[model samples]
Target: MSEHGGDRARAEAWLGQDPDPETRAELRALLDDPAALADRFGAKLEFGTAGLRGELGAGPNRMNRVTVMRAAAGLASVLTSRDDLRESSGGVSVVIGYDARHKSDVFAEDSAAVLTGAGVTVHLMPRPLPTPVLAYAVRHLGCAAGIMVTASHNPPRDNGYKVYWEDGAQIIPPLDQEISTAIDAVGRVDELPRGTDWRVLDEAVVEAYLRSLARLPLGTARDLTAAYTPLHGVGGAVLAQAFAWCGFPEPDVVAEQAAPDPDFPTVAFPNPEEPGAMDLALALGKGRDLVIANDPDADRCAVAAGGRMLTGDEVGGLLAEYVLRHTDGSDRLVATTIVSSSLLRAIAAEHGVRYAETLTGFKWIMKAGTDRDRLVYGYEEALGYSVGGDDGVPVHDKDGIGTALMVAAMAASAKESGGTLLDLLDDQARRYGLHATAQLSVRVEDLSVIADAMARLRESPPGELAGRTVTEVDDLAEGLDGLPPADVVRLRLSDGGRVIVRPSGTEPKLKCYLEVVVPVTSSPEEARTRATGDLTALREAVADALGL
Candidate 1:
């Protein structure tokens, strides 16, 4: 048989046992089209960085019922295999949560059935909620693990399933591999045992999470007007209620993008970092004091304050300054990704705080914080932040709702004290050399393009950025600074200029992080001007090296 013919035969056999009527019908329709069939059944999806995320469709390569079932059973196998869990009377408990994305609820229910049938204790969230809520419940419920059915800020056509260890952080390294091996061992869906017995959690979990948000405020929250948009996500209603409970004025909401809509009709991309994603909120905040936005799953936060949208780095600096000033940040461990601006390290050093740099993603950043009070803050360049995650299980991940509330309180206090988030940023720049950051991301249809680019750069590394000879090239693949090996390159140029390039873990894009910090020799304004120019030049040089 031809390769395509073999694909058809395997797909037909698989379809005979597929329990989902939707997917079975979809496969049947594609049987007449060999190319579509080949594309769907070409290869099974490999769970990679950020768990099992892919376009939603009817084949193994896509996010469908069969793939998710195997993933759930795989995770269940790992959970039940633990000696401690198996010894327990009730076995290990697993909390499951879902966001208001396409088929997210279905996937969550599917996971519950598989885990329960596997004799694992399963508790499903009462309804669709943010991903962080699920992360918090893992430890809050004394469960051995947690599973969240969400694609986060991915496009409308995509969905994902992520497994979190007892630490409340996503599974990393050898464990993900173990789960993948178990998934490969899954038998036919019709033959698998799927019990209907499972627990649907009450509102106590949600209420307990609110108590943590309530403690996030430090200074006085004065009269402040704000606009909030969840970008047609699940964060709106809960955030509004939290604001009401926290004694803040009702925010002006972007009605069009306020509801939970899986279609995401309002924005091209559901992420606030994307251009035009915050347009509605900005327009609504034209005369307000602040504008806040959360992505689809609400695990990330984005804020526009004092009429200017703040970058994740700037927010990181301000939040660091705030948390440190309020608590003993000196003894605490604050962390940001290596690709993020170095301004944070300067801020930490100036205040006598211990700072650490991890590889991109919260899985690495979450480890930066140790005890509840000792290790305090974690953030990434991409709008992910964890302010109150010091306490275990409750918040082991980045949370948009809590961060947004904190931003509102910060804005109010700033307004009362005659300062803005933008002013605070300028102050930070003046204190710790004017640090400027920018990014250049290239999206591609074929992921091999990214792999080829990284390989080429590794083989023939660039020696300079914007005519400045690089002082050092830290090939992250070899694991420098006691960190896990990652496919990244860090180039240190003359002055405090730096450039780091890596393929994005979640998307099919090659991302480059650029930064240049110039001393405030004469004036802060002058330093900003020079640093911006240097960053622009740095981007061009890196783009040229990448052959973009």
Candidate 2:
């Protein structure tokens, strides 16, 4: 048989066994169309550290009932095989949550049934909720595992299944590899188990998460109006409830993108970081004290205040200062991704706290916190943040809802003192020179192309970037600063700026993070323009080096 023929055969076989008539019919329709079949069955959907995520279709390469069931069965098998997990709980317990994506609820139910059939306990969220709520439930319910059915800012046709360990963070290294191996071992869709008691999750889990967020030492609450947008995702209602409970004025909602919609009609991508994602919110939010936006699943947040969208670095720096000041100089540490600006390190030093940098994912942040007993707060350049000690009740995963509430509290307190978030930021800049950060992403058609680019760069790295001498180059894969090996390269520049480049593990893109810190003067606007110009030059040099 030809490669395409074999793929069709496999897909047809799975569809033949699928119990859902609708799914089966969908598969049959695709099978008759050569182009559709080729696209659907081109390859098996990869189970990476982020688990399965792609457009939904009737092939192994897409997210569908069969693929979701297979991933659940694999997770069940891996959990059962683990001595620690099996001994702690006679059968594994998994809490599943879904968003407003197409078939998200169906996929969540499918995962529950498969796990239940494997003799595991299944708790399903009763309604569509943010991904962080599910992460909180895993720890609150004392479950051994968790799964969130979401695509999180991807286009309408895409969906995803993200797995989490009991700790509430995305699965890392060995566990991810083990789950992938188990998933690959399943030869047929029928190999998965079926039918077990799946109950709706209890309501207390959500309340517990909110209570935890309220524990942050907010100096004082003051009346401050704000605007919020969920980007047509699943975060609106619950986040509103959180703000209300925390004593902040109800936020003005961006009507167009207020409700959950799989189609995400208003934005090209549902992500708040996208260029125009917050345009609607900004348009509706004139004269507001703040504007807060959460990604589809609410695991990340972006804030706009004082007619400016705060960069993730600026947000991290402000949050670090708030947490450290509230803690009153205790031995706590602030953690950030390596690609993030080093402004936090300077802030930490002034506050007499430690600052550590991990790889460019929350997984690394969680692991770093777990290893050190002093993880007060953690953040990434991608708008993900985790507040609370590592040993806290909430899981280590980022929670945008939680972060929003914290920010509101901080904002309210600042309002009482006649200050703004920007004021706090300016103080930090004055204390620790002005640090400006920016990122450039080069999307590609294939993952292998990125790997090839990395290999080529390693073979012969450029001696200079943007006409500045390269002071030093460090291969992160060789263990930098006692950290684990990662596929990244850092270049220190003669102008005291730095550039870090790495292929995104979860997406088909190569990302470049550039940062330059210059001394602040009376004319802050001039400094910002100069720093931005330098960053633009660095981006061009990186593009040239990659031949993009």
- Compute each candidate's TM-score over C-alphas: 0.96, 0.95
**Candidate 1 lDDT, 166-272, residue by residue in tens:** 88898888888888899989888777789899999998888888887777644676589989999999998788877887888878889999889999998999999
CA lDDT, candidate 2, residue 203? 64
Best by lDDT: 1
Best by TM-score: 1
Query: Relative to the unseen true structure, what is the C-alpha lDDT of residue 468 in candidate 2, on a scale of 0 to 100?
Result: 86
In candidate 2, what are the lDDT values of residues 1-548, reduced to their tens digit? 98768767877787776766776888887776767777777778889888889988777778888889889989999988878877773467899999999999999998999898888889999899999998888887888989999998788999999998988889888789899999988766676668767888666778887887777665567578898999988899989888776777789999988888889998888888888999988877788778999999999999988888999988988887777777743557788888988887888888887778887778778777444456778888788888763333254788899888878877877877898888877777777877889988889998887888788778778899988888898898888996789899888888677889899876789988888876778656667777889889888998888777
User: How far does residue 476 in candidate 2 sit from its true spot (Å)?
Assistant: 1.9
Pairs that clash in candidate 2: none
Residue pairs that clash (backbone atoms under 3 angstroms), model 1: 372-390
RMSD in Å for model 1? 1.9
Clashes of each: 1, 0
Q: Alpha carbon lDDT of residue 75, candidate 1?
A: 85
TM-score between model 1 and native: 0.96
